[model samples]
Each structure stands twice: as structure tokens, then as C-alpha cells.
Target chain A: MLNIKDLKVSIEGKSILKGINLEVKPGEVHAIMGPNGSGKSTLSSVIAGREEYEVEDGSINFNNEDLLSLDPEERAHRGIFLSFQYPIEIPGVSVTNFIKTAINESRKAQGLDAMPASKMLKKMREKMRLLEMDQNFLSRSLNEGFSGGEKKRNEIFQMAMLEPKLAILDETDSGLDIDALRIVANGVNKLRTPENATIVITHYQRLLDYIVPDFVHVLYNGKIVKSGGKDLALELEDKGYDWVKKEADNLV
Target chain B: MEDLKEKLLSSFIAFESTLNGQAKSPIHKVRTKAIEVFEEKGFPTKRNEEWKYTNLKPILKHDYKLLSHPESEIEFKDVKRYFLHDTDTYKIVFVDGVFSSWMSRTTHDGYDICTFASAIEKYTHIVNKYFNKAASQEDSLTALNTAFAREGAFINVPDNTIVEKPIEVVFFSTNSDTEMMTMPRNLVVVGKNSQAQIIERHQSLHGNNVLTNVVTEIFAEESSHVSYYKVQNDEYTASLIDNTYVDQKEKSNCTVDTFSLGGKFTRNNLNFNLTGEHCECHLDGITIIEDDQLVDHHTRIDHKVPNCQSNELYKGIYDDKAKGVFNGMVMVHPDAQKTNAFQQNNNILLTDTASIDTKPQLEIYADDVKCSHGCTVGQLDDDALFYMRSRGIAEKEAKAMLMYAFSNDALKNVRIASLRSKLNLVFAKKLGVDLDFGL
Candidate 1:
């Protein structure tokens, strides 16, 4: 459902992602594991159409449509959702209202009528229940004064609300405790279907155990050097990214 | 420099002859002294410290005829949109400085909500006591309004009574002449242990060269609570100078909010005096101007007695070369021990050419007082803007939503429901969005 061919990306004249290729079919879960500054997050941001990055030479195709030419909101309307590592705090805008606007705007861009309020509320309630969130959480300002675990949980809640075709969770388990990690992984697992996909980006292999991935790729120095099945994550966790880095260096 | 002053000085006799029977009243004596003060000080120049940022030279060059009475009639349907139509209110409306009896809804059931022109003769003693008592005699603009003060609203809430409906005082200037000036003087006296709310607005029908100098004096007796709101959304050719003075007695609470949305040039002089102990005062203002409009707000709060508290907050958003100025001061007297006062001013410039000058001053003579003041001028937060846009909201809508959130704090404490909702709509309209929230 998504394809990236030799993606060469730079930011402010400094190359970050150099000649990276990746392809994902429908219903396949992929895990991109890397150490710090390996361009894992940058790849996700570029796919989500962040304006700061300059695509020096690359092409990104989503459902056979050129994704680079669209703005961030337009890409979002095409079912590209990025769960941020650090969710921003927007004061004075309630969580419910923010989600409502996002949903309606995306629908309007696709020539669809707005979702009925009753149906929206019902879906929101069910999703919040799945995430173990309180009823009052929907009324509070979007991410303002929210705890770390709550922010991560809220990101998953938004993922569920948007129901994107391809979701990218960038370090979703960074600041979460074990319980919050389990809740978030379980929520993601429940939403997986035969027609949707997820790209789990993490530094460690802790999140992959709950939401198992069909493919695991090791990103080193802005290039994916190793690709294997689920056992690759366990092998990398046992041995470290240093082995993979040395292998990549030898190949270079 | 002396041309406008000479014209005003020469026209005083002719204006006095119009008030035939009431020429020898106490108000006439006050008017005679006020005109003398205006003559001495004349109009303030840019050289003056208080008038350094605001220039009145361009407005003074026009030959503006001082309108004393109503010359044309205005239909209720034409101006009903300005009122708070959703709720019931005691409305005292004026057309060209004359009280529109057909358009006004005054009451005498519990307290007085009528015109000062009638109250000056009926409640002569009360009128004489608080007519110009709270206004500053030293300021030339207040003196100018006092010199030509003839018609405005007069509200008096009796002791231990709570006014059910809010009082709305609106002044609408019609485009009858090319250039016209009007002076409206308002007096509100809330008796002991009473509560009241007042909303004041000045608007013009058409874009004419109209200048308004209005003065309002409010007296809050012991334990009384009062809320006053001023809405200035006139046309581009309209200019206004508003002077409001408030006095709070022991245990009284008073709040004044000024919303300046549109105008060519507007100046507000708001002052509060806390004479008795344990009183609370709040001064809040929000200004949004575009084009070549200019809005200046000058406020002063005096904590004369011990254990009194005051809070002042003013926010402004300027765009398209508009200029805004804010000067707020909090003074604590030597005898006013254990006083608490806070003042803050925040501004956002939407364009590179738009600018804001803010000054917050605190003078505390009491050793045991807590006084603080802060001011800021900057653009919108880039991080916040990016964050909102990343969530599928367009850039323009996101910016508008963030601005609406930024202005929410200043309007949080508005006491009148209808007025608060009306201001919410106004803010939404100014931000160019149909907001789905209510105040």
C-alpha cells in the first residue's frame, strides 16, 4: 500500500536519509529499529509531509498517488497519520473539539459530509473506553498538562479516531511505563486489519513484543542495512545495534 | 494650535444660552469652571509625557461642529443589531447626543435608570453631588466633556437591591453632517450593599468624520458590586475619546472591561480609586484593530486604604499597520498596608508594520504591599502554530483558533451573559471563523 524508492532527504543542506528504499503491502506490520540519530523519525516525518525536510531526490507513493506534492493536511486526508513522540499542547481547545475539527476537515476535503455528532460521540466513547481513559479526559484541553502516559494514550486514541490506512508510531513507548505501554500496544493490536498497516518506530524492541511485527528492519546511518522476520528483533536485542553498525560499515 | 480652542471658547456662550432655565444651577457653575480649565490647558500635544505616543494634531485640524441635539430620526430596525437582542435589558439610547425617548426603555420601579438631562432637574442634589466628582479636573479631555456635557444615561441602584436586567447605554452617531463632534456624560451611583451591571457602546451608522468625547463617573458605595463593559466598534471615519472614573468604598467589588474592535482612533482613560479597606477592583481590556486604526488605553488604580486588592490585564492584537498603546499604573499609598495589586499587558503583532507600545508601572509606598507588573510584545508562537497545522487544520484556521484561545483569558470573568456571548461572537468574527464555543 506504500512505497519509498531511494528516498534522499536533507534538512538545511545536511543530508539525513540517503538513498533508502522500503515497500509495504496491505495488512503487513513493519518495525524500523535504530539507534539515536539514525533518521528513523525523519523518515516518518518525511512520509507525513513535514515541510522542514527537503527531498533532495526521492519519490513516495501512497496507493499509487504522489504524496510529496500534497500538503500535510492533504496527506492526512489520504490516511497518513503520524503519532508524534512529543505531542504538542494546544491550550483552550478541548480534546473532543480538536478531534471533531480534524475529522470534519478531512471529510470535507474528500467531498464527504461531516460525521453526525451522535455517531462521532459514540465512536469516541468506545475508543476512549478501549484506551482506559476517563470521561472527563475528552473535555480537557488538548494535551495541556497531560502526563506522559496520558499523552501516549491520547495519541493512540486519535489513531483509533482517525482510522488511518497507514499509521506511524514514532517512539510511542519512550515515556510510557509498562502498564501504559501494554495499553497502547493492545489498542494498536485491536485496530489492525487486513486492509490497514502500521510502522512501529522504536529504539528498543520492548514495544514489538506486544504488537508483533511481520518484518523487522535495522536502520543504521540513515540506511536500512538488515531486514528479517520477527526473530531479527530478538537477535538484535540479545546482541546489540553495534554488530549491525559494524556490518554496515564493512559493506560501505 | 489655538484655532480649535478659540472656536470652542467662542461657542460656549451660545451653548449656554440654549440652557435657559437651568443656567444658574450647580451644574452650570461646574461647566463654567470646566471650560476655563479647557481654555488653560487646551489640547494636549505630543510633547506632553502622557500624550507622547498618541498624536491629536490631525483630528484637531478639522472644523467639527459640536452637536447639541438630535437633527434626524433613526428607525429601531436599523440599529437594533447593536443591542444585546437575546436578553432583556434596560436600554438608554442616544442619537446625535440627544436621548431618544422613543427608543429608550427606562425604569423607576425599584431604582432610577433614566437620562442625566432629566435627573439633573429631578434629582438635583444627587446630580450635584456626583456629577463631576470622580473625573479628573486636570485632564483637558475630561474637562472638555464636562464643559459640554448635556445628555447621557443616569443609573442609581438603591441600597440592598440587586438589579435584575443589565443597563445598556448606546450612543449612535448618524451621518447628518460632514464633520460633527458630540460629548456624552454618564453617571452611575450604586448604593450600599447593591449590585449592578452596565454595558456601554459608541457606534456610527455611516463612515463620516465623527469625533466623540465621552465621560462616565461611577460611585460604588459600601459593599456594592458592579460590572461595567465598553464596546467601541465604530466605523473607520469615527474617532472616540472615553474617560471613565470609578470610586469603590469599603468591601465593594468593581470590574470594568473595554473591548476595542474597530475605529480610526480611540483613546480610553480609565481610573479607579479604592477609598475604603477590603475592596476589590478589576480592570480588563482587549483591543483588536486593523488598517490604520489606533487604540490607546491608559488606566490607573489607587489603593488608598489598607487590605485592598486590584488586578489589571490588557491584551491587544494589531494587524495591517495598526498601532496600539497601553499604559497601566498601580499606586499604593503609604497608609495602605498589606495591599495586593497585579498588572499585566500582552500584545501580538500580526504584521511586520503593525506595532504595540506597552508600559506597566507600579508605585508602592507601603512597605507591606505586594505589587507586580509585566508587559510583553511579540508574534504568535511558531511552535503552537505548527502543532495545530500538523493536526489537519489549515494554517489560517489554526492561527485563528490559537488567537481565540489567547484572548479567552481576558474575557473569562465577564459577568453579563448576553454581553459575554456577544463579545464571543465579536471575537470570532474578527478572527474570521465560525467558532463553535460559547462564553
Candidate 2:
């Protein structure tokens, strides 16, 4: 459902992603595991069309459409969702209102009528229930004074509500306890379908045990150096990234 | 330079003759003294520190005819939109500085909500004691208003009487073809243990050059509670200089909210004096201006006695070369121990040409006092904008939503329900959005 060929990205004249290639098909879950500063988050941001990163030479095609030419909101309307690691706090905007605006804007972009308020509220309640959130949580300001676990769960709740075609969970497992991890992973697993795809970006292999990715790729120094099945994550966790670094260094 | 002042001095005789018995009363003596003060100070120039950011030389240059009578007739159906129609209120309406008895609904049941001219004769003792007592006589504009103050609202809530209906003091200037000026003075006294709410507005019917210099003095007696709301939404040709002074006695609570939505130039000098122990005062203002508009808010709160608290919040949004100024001062006297005062002034400049100057001053002489002040001047948060945009909201809608959220903090404290809803609609219209969210 997503394709990236020779992706070269830089920020402020400093190169971050250099000549990377990745492809994901429908009905498959991909996990990109790497150490710190490995451009895992940058890749997710580039795919979601963040403006800060300058893509010097790259081509990102989502559903056979040129994604780089679209704005962030346009890409979002095309079912591209990026769950941020540090959710921003928007004071005075209730979560329900914000989500409704987002949903209506996306629908308008596609020349569709806005969803009925009753249906939206019902769907929001159903999604919040799946994430084990209180009904009052929807009335509070978006992510303002929310706990880390609550923020992560709220991200998953948004993903469920939007039903994005390609969901990139960038470091979603960070700052989450075991119980939150289980709940988030369970929520993601429940939403998986044959036509949708998921890319789980993480530094550790703990999140993969619950979500259980079909493919695991080790990203070192901006490029994916090795690709294998779910066992590769366990291998990286047990033996550490030193072997991957040495192997990448030898290949260079 | 002396043309407007000389004209005002020459017109005083005609203005004085209008007051039947009040010409020889003690209030006239105060007026005579006030005119002398105005003659001495003249119009404040830019050299004055307080008037540095604001230049009144242009507004004072106009050859404005002081309006003493209604020049044109206005049907109540034509101007009824200005009033809060949904709420029950005691309305004191004025047209061209003259009271419109047909348009006003005064009260005589237990409390006095009538015109200043009648109140001066009917409740002579109350009018003589509280009139012009709390306002500053040193300022030239205030002194100017006092010299010309004749017809306005006078509200008196007796001791221990809770006023059920809020009072609406509306001044409508219908000088369609001529440049005119009006001064409206209001005196409100809430007796001990009484409570009252008031809404004041200045509206011009046509886009003519109309200047309104208003002065309102509110005295909250011991343990009384008062809330006053000022809505200044006039045409581009209208300018207003509002001087409001409030005095709170022991255990009293008072709040004044100033909303400057539309005006060519507006200056508000709001002062609150906490005279006794355990008193609370709140001053809140929200200003939204665009296209060469200017709104300046200068507030001072004096914690004169112990165990008093004061809070001030002012927010401004300037767009397209508009200018805004906020100067807030809080003073805790030597014996005013355990005083808690907080002041915050925040502004957002939507364009490169828009500007805001904010200064928050705190002078604490007491040993034990909690006084904190915060001020910020900047554009909207880029990260917050991006966060909203990435959630599928368009860029313009996202920016408007963020601006609405930024101003919501000040709008939440609006005490009157109908006025609050009206303000919400005003804000939505300013932001160019159809906001249906519950406030």
C-alpha cells in the first residue's frame, strides 16, 4: 500500500535519511527496529508529509498516488496517519470537538457530507471504550495535562476513529508501562484488516510481542540493513545492535 | 490647540442652563472645578509617559459639536438589536446624550435604576455622596467627561437587597451627518450585602465621526457583590475613552469585564481600590481589532488593606496593522499583609505590521504578600498549528481554531449568559467560522 524508493532527506542542510528503500503491501505488519538516531522517526515523519524535513531526492507513492506533492492535511485525507511520540497539548479544545473537526474536514476534502453528530458520538464512545477510556476524557482539552499512558492510548483511539489506510506508530511504545502496552497493542490488533497495513517503529522488541509483526527490519544509520521475520526482533534484542552495526560497517 | 477646549468652555453656559436646580447645587461646584482642571491639563500629548503609545492629537483636532439634545428620531424597532433582548433588564437608554424615556424601562421598586438627572433630585443625598468620588480628577479626559456629564444612568441597590434583573445602560449616537461628541456618566452604588450586575454599551447608528467619553463610578459597600460588563462595538468612525473607577469595602467582591470588539480607537482606564479587609477584585478584558484599529487598556488595583485579593487578565488579538496596549499595575500597601494579587497580559499579533506593548508593574510594600505578574507577546505556536493541521484540519481553520482556543480563557469568565453567547458569536464572526461548540 506504500512505496518509498531511494529516499534522501535532510534537515537544515544536515542529512538524516540517505538512500532508503521500503515497500509495504496490504494485510502485512512491518516493524522497523533501530537504536537511537537511526532515522526511524524521521522516516515516519517524511511519510506523513512533515514540512521541516527537506526531501532532496526521493519518491513516496501511497496507493499509486504521488504523496510528496500533497499537504499534511491532504495526506491525512488520503488515509495517512502518524501517531506522534510526544502528543501536543492544545488547550481549550475538547477532544471530542477536535476529533469531530478533523473528521469533518477530511470528509469535506473528499466531497462527502459531514457525519451525523449522533453517529460520531456513538463511534467515539465505542472507540474510547475499546481503549478503556472514561467518558469524561472526551470532554477535557486535547492532551492537556494528560498522562503519558493516556496520550498513547488517545493516539490509538484517534487511529481507530480515522481508520487510516496506512498507520505509522512512531515510537508509540515509549513511555508506556506493561499494562498500557498490552492495551495499545490489543487496540491496534483489533483494528487490523486485510486491506489495511501497519508500520510499527520502535527501539525495543517488547511492543512486537503483543502486535506480532509479519516482517522485522533493522534500520542502522538511516538505511534498513537487514530484513527477516519476527525472529529477527528477538535476535536483535538478545544479541544487541552491535552485530548489525558491525555487519553494516563491513558492507559499507 | 486650544480650539476644542475654548469651544467647550464657551458652551458650558448653555450646558449649565439646562440643569434646573443642579446649577446652584454642590455637584455644579464639582463640575466647575473639573472644567478648571481640564483647562489646566488640556489634552495629554505623546510626551506623557502613559500616552506614549497612543496619540490623541488627531482625534482632538476634530471640530466636534457637543451634542446636548437628540438631533434625529430613532424608532425603538430600528435600534432594538443593540439591547440584550432575550434577558430581562432595567434599561436606561440615551440618544445623543439625552435620555429617551420611550426607549428606557426604569425601576422604582425598592432600588433606583433611573436617569442621572432625576436621581440627582429624587435621591439627592445618595447622588451627592457618591457622584465623581471614585474617579480621578487629575486626568484630562476624565475631567472633560465630568465637566459635560449630565444625562446617564444612576443605579442604587439598597442594603441587603439582591437585584433580580441586570441593568443595561446603552448610549446610542445618531449623529449621521455631523461630527459630534457625548459624555455619559454613570453612578452605581451597591449597598451592604446587596448584589447587582450591569451591562454597558456605546453604539453609533451610522458611520459618522462620534466620540464618546464615558465615566462610571461603582461603589461596592461592605460585603456587597457587583459584576459590570462593558461592550464597546462601534463603527470605524466612533472612538471611546472609558474611565471606570471601582471602590470595594470590607469583604466585598467586584468584577469588571471590558470587551473591545469593534472601534476605531478605544482607551480604557480601569481602577479598583480595595479599601477594606477580605475584599476581592477581578479585572478581565478581551480586545480584538483589525485594520488600523487601536485598543489600549490601563488598569490599576490598590490593595489598601490586609487580607485582600485581586486578579487581572487581559488578552488582545491584533491583525492588519492594528495596535494594542496593556498596562496593569498592582500595589500592596505597607499594612496590607497577606495580600494576594495576580496579573497576566497576553497578546497575539497575526501580521508583521500588527503590534502590542504590554507592561505589568507590581509594587509590594508589605512583608508577606503573593504578587505575581506574567506578560507575553508573540504569534501562535507553530507546533500547535502543525498538530492541528496534521489531524486533517485545513491550515486556515486550524489557525482560527487555535486563536479561538487562545481567547477562550478570557471568555470563560463572562458572568452574563446572553452577553456571553453574543460574544461567542462576535468571536466566531471575527474568526470567519461557524462555531457551534458549547461555550
Candidate 3:
């Protein structure tokens, strides 16, 4: 559903993602693993239409529409979601109210009426239960004084509510405990469908134990140097990223 | 004196000449001294340290009608929406500095909830003891208000008497002959163990320019409680210089909140004097102005006795070419040991042209006291804005959300739900958003 052809991106004339080529069809999970400063997040932000990244050359086409031409909210309305690695805190805005506003705005952009209060409440309650969130958590300020686990869980909760076609989980497993990781992966697995796709960007293979990906691509030095099946994750986890770096260096 | 100052000084003299027969009245001495102070100090200029950021030349250049002329009457229905109509309140409504007996609901039976004129005539003892006592004699604006303190709200809750209803003091400037000015002087004396809530507002019902120079003195006696709320939302032709002072006694608590949402020019001088032990003072304000509006909040809290605490937080959002100023001064006396005072001012400048000047002054004398003050002025967080927009909220809606959240922290202490919802609506309207956050 989403295609990228030789996507060369940079920020402030500094090269970040150098000539990237990737494509993903429906009902597929792609894992993009890289060490620090390997252009993993730059790729996700560029695809989600964060205006700071300048595309030197290439095109991002989603569902036959130019994704780069649309604004962030427009991209979101067209079923593209990016779960931020570090969700910003909005003090005095409650979690439930934030989600309610997000859902209503997306609906309004699609020329639909606002969801009824009762229906919205039911859906929220159901999703909160799926995420194992407490009922009292709905009234707290969005991400204000929340723990690391709670922030990631809230991001997943938003993804579940929006039901995006292309959802990018950027570093979702970085700050989670073992139990939180399992719960987050379990929630993602339950929401998967034959017509939707997800891109899980992680450094370790622990998350792959639950929501296993269909394809694993090793991203290094602003380029994807290797691509393999899910077993490659375990192999990289065993041999470490240093070995991959050496192999890529030898190729250059 | 400058032109406007000389005009005001002579105007006061002419008005004072008519009260010759009643010179022996109890308020005569106070009025005489107040006029002298006004003459000696004149009007504050930009040279003064406190008035450096706020210039009064433009707003004071108007030739105001201190004395009223015959004008059309205001209907109850036309002005009813301005009141907190959901609940019954003791309202002392004024139309261009004149007490409207028909529009007011006052009582002198159990408690003294009446006009300042009647209070000075009937309850001279209470008025003589508390009126102008807590306020400054050095401030020319306060002295000016005292000199013209013929109309205002006079609320007196006796010792151990908790007022059943909140008091509403409203000053409305309607269609006048020329540019009109009104001075509202309020004196609230909550006796020992007493409690009362008051909401003060100055509104202009017409497009004509109206300058309201108001002064309010509150006396919270031993162990008493009082909450004062100032709602300054009016036409762009209105300007206000509000001076409020509070004197707290042992074990007393006082809170003053000023919500400045609209006006052409506004300057708020809030001073809290904690003279007794175990006193608590809370000063919070929220200012949201667009266009060429200007609002300045200058607060001073004096911790004179031991074991006292004070908290002050003021937040603002300036859009367009609007300007804002916040000066929070906290002082701890030499003998006031174990005192705690905290002051914070946060502002968001929406556009590059919008500006804010914030300063926090902390003068700590006691060695063991704890005092801290901070100030911040910046634009809304880009990361937060992006996060909201990526969730399908448009750019305007997202900016509104972040701005509202940034300013709503100061509204956490608002006890009035009806007023809070109205404020939320005003915020939504000002921010150009379709959602009402009161829900």
C-alpha cells in the first residue's frame, strides 16, 4: 500500500537517509533495525510528512496519492499514523478528551458527523480494557507526569482508536519493561488485519518474539545494507550489530 | 503635571467644592488626604521602575467625563447575560459610576451587602476602620480612586457569619455623551471566622471609550477567608487600571484571581499583606489577548510574619501584535522566619510580532525563609504542535489546544463552575476553535 523509490532525504543540507528504496504491500510487517544515528527515525518522519526533512530526490506514494504533498493532518486523515518515540506532554489536557478530539477531528475532515458521546465512551472503555489501562487514567493530563511505559501504552491506544492503514511504531519498545513489552505487542497483534500494514522499528529481537515481522531489513549509515526473513533478527541479536557494520564497511 | 493629570486634578477640586456642606462627614478627611496624594504624585510615568514596561501616555490622553450627563437607560434583559445567572447572587450593579437601585439586589438585614455610598453613611465605623487602610496612599491611581470613591460594592460579613450567596460587583459603561471614566472603590471586611466570595467586573456596553480606574481593599480578619475574582472582558474601547489590596490576619486565607480576556489596555496592581502568623495567600491570573491589546499584571506579596505562605502564578497568550507584562515581587521580612513564597510567570507568544516582558523580583530578608521566583516567555512547543496535528487536528485547532493547555493551569483554583464554563467559551472563541473545553 506504501511505496518509496530511492528516497534521498536530508535535514539542513545534511544527508540523513541516502537513496532509500522500500515497498510494502498489505498485511505485511516490516522491521527496520539500526543502531543510533543510522537514519531509522529520519525515514519514519519523512514518510509521515514531518516538514523538517527535505526530500532531495524521490517520491513517497501511498494508495496512488502523493504522500509528500499532503500535510501531517491530511496524511493522518488518509489513514497514516506515526507513534512518536517521545510523545510530547500537553498539560491540562486529559487523555480521554485528547483522544475524543483526535477522533472527532479525523471524522470531521472525512466529512462525517461526530461520534455520539455514548458510542465514544464505549469504544474508549473497550480499548482501555484491551490495553489494561485503569479507568482513572482517562482523566489525567496527556503524557504529563506519566511513566515511560504509560506513554508508549497511550500511543498504542491512539493507534488502536485511529485504526490506521500504515502505522509506524518508532522505537516503541525502547522504554518498556518485559511485561509492558508483552502487553504492547499483544495489543498490536490483536489489531492486525489482512488489509492493514505496520512497520516496527526496534534495535533488539525481543519484540519480534510476539508480533513477528514478515521481513527484516538492516539499516546502517543512511542505507539498508541487508534484508532477510524473521530469523535474521535472532542471528543479528546473537552476533551483534558490530559484525553487520564490519560487513557493510567491507562492501564499501 | 501633564495635561491629563492637570485635567484630573482640577476636576477633583471642582467635584470636591460641591461637598462643602458635608465636610464634617466621616469620609471627608480620607478624601482630602487622598486628593493631596494624587496632587503630589500625579500620574505614573514610564520613568518609574514599576511603570517602565507600561506606558500610560496613549490611554491617558483621552478627555474623560468624570461627571455623568443624562443618558439612555439600560434594560435588565440586555445586561442580564453578563451576570452569573445560573445562581442567585447579591449584585451591586453600576451604570457609568452611578448606583442603579433597580438593577441591584442588596440586603442590610442579616449582612451588609449594599452600595459603597450607603455603607459609608450607615456603617461608618466599619468603613472608617478598613476603607483605604490596606490600600496604598502613595499610589496615585489608588488615591485617585479613593478621591472618587462615591460608588462601588460594600460587602461586610460580620464575625462568624458565612455569607450564603456570592456578591457580584459590576460596573457597566454604556453609551455616554463623550469618553467616560469610572472609579469603583470596593471595601470588603470579612470578620473573624467569616467567609465570603466576590466577583468584580468592569464592562463597557457600547463602543465608546471608557477608562475604569478601580481600587478594592479587603480585610480578612483573624481566621477569616475571602476569595476575590476580577473578570475584565469588554469592548476593545475599554481600558482598566485595577488596584487591589488585601490585609490578612492570623490563620486567614485570601485568594485573588484576575482573568483578563479582552480590553484595549489593562493594568492590574495586586498586593497581599500577610501581617499575621499562619496566613495563606494565593494570587493567580490568566490573560489571553489578541490584536493590539495590552495587559500588565504587577503583583506583590509581603510575608511579614512567621509561618506564612504565598503562591502566585500568572500565564498569558499574546497573538498578533498584542503585548503583555508580568512583574511578581515577593518579599520576606527580617523577622519572618520559616516563610514560604513561590512566584511563577509563563507566557506564550503566538506570532513573531507578539511580545511579552516578564520579571520576577524576590527580596528575601529572613535567613531561614524559602522563596523562589521564575519567569518564561516563548512560543508554543513545536513538538507538541506536531504531535497534535499528526493525530488529525488541524493546525489552528492544535495551536488552540496547546495554548489553552498552557493557560489553563492558572484556572485550577477557580471555584465557580458557571464562570469557568463561560471562560472556557471565551477562550475557545478567542482561539478560533470549535471545541468547548469545559466538558
Q: Model 3 chain B — which ten-residue stretch has the worst lDDT?
A: B430-439
Report the lDDT tens digits of candidate 1 across residue range A1-252: 899999999999999998889999889999999999999999998998788899999899999999999888888888988899888888887899888888887888889998998999999999999999999999999899999999999999998999999999999999999999999999999999999999999999999999899999998898899999999999999998999999999999
Please give the DockQ score of every candidate, comma-separated. Answer: 0.50, 0.70, 0.74
Query: In candidate 2, which residue pairs clash?
Result: none
On TM-score, the candidate that comes out on top is 2
Name model 3 segments beyond 4 Å from true: B436-439
Clashes of each: 0, 0, 0
Sorted by DockQ, highest first, which candidate order results?
A: 3, 2, 1
Candidate 3 — which pairs collide? none
Off by over 4 Å in 2: B437-439
**DockQ of candidate 1 against the true complex:** 0.50
Candidates' TM-scores?
0.96, 0.98, 0.98
B1-439 per-residue lDDT for model 1 (tens digits): 3477788888888899999988998899999999999999999999998889999888888778774666567899999889997889999999888889898999998999999989988899899989999999899989988998778999989899999888999998886566778889999999999999999999888777888889999999999999999988889998999999999999999999999998899999999999999999999899989999999999999889999999999999998999999989888999999999999999999999998888898898889988889999999887666655556777787788778877776887798777887788888899876575331
Tell me the tens digit of each residue's lDDT in model 3 across B1-439: 2477777778887887877675767687888889899989988899999999999978888877778543568999999988996888889988888889899899986789998888877888888888889999889899988887777899999999999687889988885567887788898999999999999988888888888899999999999989888998888999999999999999999999999999999999999999999999999999999899999999999999999999999999998999999988898989899998989998888889988989899998999988888988888888888898898888888887887777777778878787777777777778776764333
Global lDDT of model 2? 0.91
lDDT of 2 by residue, B350-381 (tens): 99999998999999999999989999999999
